[model samples]
Target: MTTTPKHDERIATMTFASVYPHYVTKVEKKGRTKAELHQVIRWLTGFDDVRLQELIIENVTFKTFFEQATINPNAHLIKGVICGYRIEDIETPLTKEVRYLDKLVDELAKGRKMEKILRSTS
Candidate 1:
């Protein structure tokens, strides 16, 4: 059976290497857990665990925008220190907060590197 993480054991990404093993990238914060890293892996590669293994056999260069965002354990059921990354959860107007996140995801999907994306924000 697929036993889930304990309420306190939600995962997160602390380093880019945890997800992007091939990129030799680094995040300013600490690295995330195996499971936390997996979400980004799946999101970046566009492949589930099963499909990922299959693709690995073909030797492909898959990339994902490795980032760490806070997870609200009580709300989305994904809680962690990473929650600090969500501006909406921390401040007012969650709707606006999500719009920004959506835009970020879109930019990331379009091959925009995280460093470049962050530079624009600052």
Candidate 2:
């Protein structure tokens, strides 16, 4: 019964561009390439490189980002703990989507195989 923290409100309003660098930094610190990070983001959000760049240039908030996203049907396959919260256990739809991205980035940082992280478990 964990309540949504006040900080989550700020997170929802934060721009994707503002957070993009941190994601790049996290993955790059573990020897992952920015292209790989892009691939994961595209896989989750259905944003191609050009569209992704547009969102960054426009400084879209996470709430707006997900609002416009064509989230992959397989996204629910992403299951894990991130920042002490289980992705599947998150109650708010928007928060769960945000955490889904976080979990994917965490996997990328941890060096999980791209196919596994993308849940291409076929």
Instruction: Compare the candidates by TM-score and give the number of the best one.
Output: 2
Local distance difference test, each candidate: 0.34, 0.91
lDDT of 2 by residue, 1-122 (tens): 33376757876898999989999999999999999999999999999999999999999999999999999999999987887888778887888898899999999999999999999968
Clashes of 1: 11
Off by over 4 Å in 2: 1-5
TM-score of 1: 0.27
lDDT of 1 by residue, 1-122 (tens): 22123311222212222334422122212332334334444543244666545444544321122122232222332212232344334332232223243333434444556444333334
Q: How well does each candidate superpose onto the true structure, as a TM-score?
A: 0.27, 0.93
**Over the full model, what C-alpha lDDT does candidate 1 score relative to the true structure?**
0.34
Worst 10-residue lDDT window for candidate 2 reads: 1-10
Off by over 4 Å in 1: 1-19, 23-29, 62-122
